[model samples]
Target: MARQEPLVRAASAVRTVVEQGADDGYAGLEISGDRVLLWWKGAPPPAVTDTARAAGVAVEVRAAEHSREELRAAADRLWRSSGVEHGGQLQAVKIISDGRGLEAAVRPGRKSPLAPLPELGVPVDVVEQEPPTPTSRCDDGVPWYGGLAIRPSGEWGGACGGNENLRYTCTGGFGVHIGSTEYLLTAGHCATVGETLLDGAGQYIGEATLRHAEHDLVLVRTDAADRIWDGVPGVSDFTKPVVGWVWTFPGQSLCYSGATSGANCGYTVVKDEYTKFCYEGRCWSDLIAAKRKGRFSVAGGDSGGPVFSLINNSAWIQAAGTVTGTLQQTDLLGNKTEWVIFQDFGTATRDWPGLDTINYLDPM
Candidate 1:
């Protein structure tokens, strides 16, 4: 049997009426069920009314500044007259007018029935909620992990091609003192040959002296030094210690970081061989996996953000790895691939066959 195309009727009917000696305005159209709704910025010409009559569409007119209730009443009447018993498929034509311009949208009807109106005399005002803080306590001290908190200082190009200026954004991943003075770790991609890191004030901090492209790890050096801590701390007198290494394990609780989403704590889903294909090299392997679920989380701009673990009373801690991949899925079980992987200092040296000779970082 031949199938028929589903009907796509207009959401509402519209007609325009213009005031004499005023410029005639145009109407916006929206579709809902079999009806087409019309909205206009100013009074429309009588021609608009003739056009609607020709199309056999009903028309409703309201002042440009009609209240929500007033608009709803008109729509309800139109919906009832149209014989649309269920409100779910109802559509509305909305119009807004400023002296200079007009805008319109065709909106689907409310999914659910409107809730009972609030008490008539009650005062109401909308309030926005503040975001939760991302810092947490660990053995070393408190650390900033999540949110779009990383601020860029300055940028230089010339890494990928001939004098190509690469815009560098400032992040917390570069020159992170893991354990040893010789092995500074950061996002591999960030350590491009011609790139540099800048501070919040746009001062040059370090140069991308070394990089592991496959694992996306970079190593750099700077004159500044500070003691790294594990947990979130208030103002204190404890001298900050330099972190050389971080201990991590499978299923250990840890935090994932990025510039925009900030930090989120998730367990190590897996710590096995993670093979990553690079844009210019063979597949790389052996990366850590950190997973978390929260409203504020990681995204693309956070590629080299650090993943940290707190353990042993927050006394012993080290960098587990860097974020490399993110996965998107249509189902909860993630049966499909939506993964984003990052290269870290250790993984880059370990996986890339030629990286050790090129960048001087020892194999993990």
Candidate 2:
């Protein structure tokens, strides 16, 4: 398992330099194992190289044909022309990590192939696939911990219950404090604003006050604790207190706990700032992507669950992201693999200023 403290420092430091340095050639960055992969349109900048080296991790500077800005512009143009956002075959579009080109996801067996838009300045890598969803399949409570079952109040939802009552909705994420009010967190797609959230026992937990559909995040007004359920759900009971939160990075191993799927580990972070189109032109950027190290990591009711990294191999964890949804990728050999899509906490804080998890900096 990856430790949180060192990884947080390294990633935060590298990201700070990247944000401060207005290098146009800056393609992107990736934390591969213990080293940093710095991609650039030309040669990597010396300041960035020195910073990465100073972080006490190995550094690999890569060359790219196009800059990030150019690729983003190209992606926008592709979205406008490809009609992927307009309920077309295009599932998602993103600037590949290597910064060489853009990868466009299109539906398989569609009637018409996307036209060769020579107009796009960058090369477009097309992959036949389907788009991801909000993962609402539907979590718990007064200082409520995360990873427990929750759903729209008065609705028969979630993976719990017997017989026909097995309606799954979502899992509660980390609890946060915005100003003087405390609130629970979950995926925005799970429920609309004003819907009251309830536990399996039908106890009132909170009310959905804010929904950011574009970012796939929701804030429920209630009392929440800075802790998460790490147990096996009815089999074993264990909980972890969230010490802090960190940004997502490629190759970072993490885990998640869902109400339906329980808790599964051995997932590696795959991509950052990925832009995905769900349905009818609805799209969002800055979304994190991870590949399952095992057969499965999340399920239909896992939305809004906590994505976290272990702390020093102990039960303590650091919040990473909110479970958004999953996508299936088929290889040439007909083998299918699933990937987890989420909105990281870093993006959450950036979008909602002064927004932070309860006890975020409390001593572990």
Provide the overall lDDT of each model, using Cα atoms, as 2-decimal numbers.
0.35, 0.74
Q: Pick the candidate with the highest TM-score.
A: 2
What does candidate 1's lDDT look like per residue over 1-364, in tens digits?
A: 0010011111112211221222343323333234444445556566666556565444444333332233334433433432123222222121121111111111223333433323322122211111111111111112222111122234432111111232223234523432333323456544475566553234455566666654556665544332222222222213222233232322334554444344445443332223222222222333444444433344444556556543334432334466654534334764432233444334543443322211113212
What is the C-alpha lDDT profile of model 2 across 101-210, one tens digit per residue? 88877777653556665478788777777767556511244568888778787677744623244344688888887798888888888778999988766678889998
Q: How many residue pairs clash in each candidate?
A: 61, 14
TM-score attained by model 2: 0.87
lDDT value, candidate 1, whole model: 0.35
Q: Tell me the TM-score of each prediction against the true structure.
A: 0.41, 0.87
**What lDDT is reached at residue 107 by model 2?**
72
